[model samples]
Target: MSSMAERRHGISTPAASTQLKLRFIDRDEHVYFWFPLLAGLSELTFDPRQEIRHSALEVLFDILRFHGGSFAQSFWVRIFDSVLLPIFDHVRAEVTDTTTFTSEKRRQQEEQWLYETCTRCLQHLVDLFVQFYDEAFTLLSRLLDLLRGFMNRSHQSLAAVGVAAFVRLAVKAGPIMNETCWEEVIAALLAILEETAPEARDLITPPPRLNPAVAAAVATAVATAAAPISTSVSSAISSEITPASGSGSPSGGPSAHHPPTAPSGAAMANGGGGAAPVGAGGRTFTLREGVGARRLAKFRCQAATQLLLVQGCSEIYANASQSLPPGAVRGLLDALAFIHRHAHAADMDMDLRRRLAVQQ
Candidate 1:
């Protein structure tokens, strides 16, 4: 009766199936109706279409849940190799081109989707290992390698997510992570924080101001020195002006032309410029549109990434301070101190600065 019920639900009961089909879902014998029907799902998980790929992952998760530890160890290993590792590679490839999206909103949406998907994948993988802690311990070193790859990404959003995920795993693994693993984790986190630290001038410095008297005197002197140069430039332009097709000069003599001129003061100050000043090597320098805004955005992103790192570092320290060796604790403290000096110098949000301060 039990065997009949198991067969009805399509469960692979050992009683009604050969040992080979019952253990390895990949077995050819399982292609028939009585099997668990997982054929081609692994291939589908790597489909080029996003919807298909997502659906396949969802189905795999469901299958894992339904099996309730009934699957063979080899089956789990196969999932790790084919499904989990490949999904991670796919995610990295997708995220590498995230900035290529022309629209800000679209880029943000895609990043958010990737973050959620990556988080879900990490959570599921870690939870699986946590369930069989003793047996799965060896596999987690590879998982740490994956986490390190994510944390090392140049994309700020993905890096933050990686740091958060790594911190969670580190805390969960606790003493399970050997000394070398713990050292590597701390080293990686500190390197990221150091790389992302904001420059002091960009954050903390104010623009210089000039007195009214000094400004007025400077302007008068510049205008006086520039008057003759301006006249010479106008003469040069009139001589060089050429007729455009049939639109000859009204008077047919260089059209009495005067090309647009730079401000007299600036032209003379910049050493005989007709339009604008040129830098060394005759290269013109122009401020790009929205450069300040772009720089500010970049600064904010770096700050945010650093904030995540700091928080993760603090969490790791809190979790393992007692258990960590004295040398490890000293290294963490040095990293934290370095961050404290640099972060306080940067003009970050008061609340975040205070959090760092308090954590220190």
Candidate 2:
């Protein structure tokens, strides 16, 4: 009976039937119809038509709802290698048919679809990074460059959430690298953090007081992450991070970078990316002194505001533990540890927040 039902739902793909055995929805609650859905998503990435591509993205995103704590460990890498990477490479080069001079309206519409679609996928990827930071460590440099390009002036509208996505990834990625390398990422984040912070009400008001708790996380990330490989970030960035949209591609110029990822979240400052300003214009900004309070507050996770905050956010994963079918959580945890290291800075005030965190 179950086998017949699986076939009716289009869950019986070659890959799913062979490797996955049963549809994620049918076989195990731990992984809902993962076998068939995962297989279907993998195929969608290679579809030649834009419409097909869009549909595939949507389905994969829908499935991501089932991915969370455990699912991340079960299926993230399969998506990364089999689905994301391939689609990333394919979509990197936007197909331009000379005959199909897509009108401005058409182009804008397509871009909008892509933007929304990417956000969904990117968010899931963020979950993976948070769960398995180290698994996604090799992706840090790539992610940094990606954020800059996505949030830059080129794609102003799309960049809004794009910037947030970058922040989450940075928070997660920063801790996985060795000390020296980690600083590089943090330096970039500090610049971003500074930009997001309100202008200290005439620069004399102690610089937008920061949360001792959050500062600790940022401090930790800067303190850890990345190994010193004598290579320049700019150079490595060229090879590592490719914008999802063939960014900076001058209509007919160079191709943009590609590595399709999940969605990210951030708060706008009337707003913001990269590099610490030298000497802070004769001022000082260090871990000892602490970053502004507003920056710390962003990731604070208001337990109360959870309803409002998650309103627009599609309830993808029912519980924090039920999603990410397989092997994904490891990646998220590794990344979360990294982000915690840098963004939280809560460590510095752990003794204090410890009481708070414990209460929660």
Candidate 3:
């Protein structure tokens, strides 16, 4: 009984003793081993084998999570440049190079692992430092740009991982995400849904808007300008008018300027074609080519990935709605509804459709 009590009094277990030691250990102790450890791990991240790279990244992330703020900014930047940035370039190269793998299945498996590692690393970086460091916002923007590129790739695996990562970022980083970041994420997700469910594209797509008052004014001005040109052209054609001074050569009959074409009011009102010149947000919006049924089938084949994205959508709606701007919130709501409707219409499993309806 005495032995038991004595043992329990101090350093009772390995964990307890370790914690006790940690409490007394100066933060400066890490300085001795930090760079050396980072150096070793940084080398491992570039290894040709995926497993080694993944393990190295896991260690790096663990260090960041536990002691992220303890180190100098330069150390963190070294990790960012040497360890994090290289992984991005490596994964991208691996995904695009078809000759590396002997078979498609192996390629996909390798790609999937690479993508999952990339996402896990990114999540650790953003979740650990986004609030405390200003540099993190820049990282967040770079993350969005990377994910956007991933979503644009032809591989279903790439798109799936991109969407999943995007959703996670939005749900986790909602408070810190600025308006531009929010819009970019929202735009990327909608682009995915638009590709996966072409039939419902119109439902979620934002219609081109020109202020009615502006449209009316522009149309009136165009009509007033076109009338004189039309009358002049008709009279010139009827009279078979010759060149007007320097407008055309005297020997050239019925000069090109004689039948000058003026844009009609409707054409001007339509913004030159069927689309608006620019959006209200000061961005030019253009739709991609229509996604085909084969692509939809590919999306269906990756049901797990699709479900991940759907759950992410629900999470963003449930947890981040208040943090988002009004426009983004409205866009998310519309996206969620569209997903539910498409799932039901496509005869997707009842549970998925339900998940879409329930936020988070």
After superposition, the stretches of candidate 3 with alpha carbons farther than 4 Å from their true spots are 1-40, 46-51, 70-79, 98-101, 129-135, 178-184, 187-311, 334-360
Measured over all alpha carbons after superposition, the RMSD of each candidate to the real structure, in angstroms, is 18.7, 19.8, 17.1
Better model by lDDT, 1 or 2? 1
All candidates' TM-scores? 0.53, 0.34, 0.48
- For candidate 1, report its TM-score: 0.53
Show where candidate 1 strays beyond 4 Å.
1-55, 62-81, 198-299, 319-328, 344-360
Candidate 1 vs 3: which has more lDDT: 1
> Best lDDT goes to which candidate?
1
lDDT tens readout by residue for model 3, 1-360: 764675777537666565545221223555455656766776677576878977897897777667765545555555566556666677677775743554988776776676676677656655665643544454555667677666555566666667766777787777777788778777767766655553322211223344555456546657788544355344443243221111122112121224313324543332333333232344432333222233344444445445656777777888887798887887787787866665565343332222223211
Tell me the lDDT of model 3 at 82: 57
- Going through the candidates in the order shown, the clash numbers are 0, 76, 1
In terms of lDDT, which candidate is stronger, 2 or 3? 3
Computed on alpha carbons, the lDDT of every model, listed in order, comes to 0.57, 0.41, 0.56
For 282-311, candidate 1 gives per-residue lDDT tens digits of 443222223323445566667777677778
